[model samples]
Target: MDTALIVGYLASICSVTSFIPQVWKIFKTGDTAAISAKMYALTVTGFALWTAFGVMRVEWPIILTNAICFCLSGLILIKKITRRAR
Candidate 1:
């Protein structure tokens, strides 16, 4: 593959994996106290929009990357909201 494509893939991988630690920490500790709900809300919305844009443009990398991020951020957002509700 080309250098740009390789870099894109690496960036995607890094982006996707970046959320794992936060998710795992929340899972293990059940603490959403420090996570910003508004930020994650915007993040989830942004990722969702990006995924839709990717779908419209037929770009698998963008679609997959944003979709994964959407789900991950969505999970964190959900946890934050629900924990706050209780």
Candidate 2:
């Protein structure tokens, strides 16, 4: 109901879904040659850390969004690593 809370939700939704396209593209076409392993590794790690922090703080929005982001980034990271091995 507050403006800040509304903004937080909106921002979280946008950030959380931002990885969907990348994950979908990587799996759909099996093309991860251009995806940087370091970048995604850092991203997933960062999201996991943020999710933990959110959980510690008991912030539902942060926990929910970062958890989603962690999973999505983890998916991409996994795909990139596996593709590079082939």
Q: Model 1: runs farther than 4 Å from truth?
A: none
- Candidate 1 residues 13-79, lDDT tens each? 9999998898889978999999999999999999999999989998777888899999999999999
Cα displacement (angstroms), candidate 1, residue 30, comes to: 0.6
lDDT of 1 at 82: 96
Which clashing pairs does model 1 show? none
lDDT on C-alpha atoms for all candidate structures: 0.92, 0.88
TM-score of each: 0.91, 0.92
| Candidate 2, 1-86: lDDT as tens digits | 88877887888999978888988898899998888999989989999999999999987778889999999889888888888888
> Model 2: which residue pairs collide?
none
Candidate 1 local lDDT, residue 69: 92
Clashes of each: 0, 0
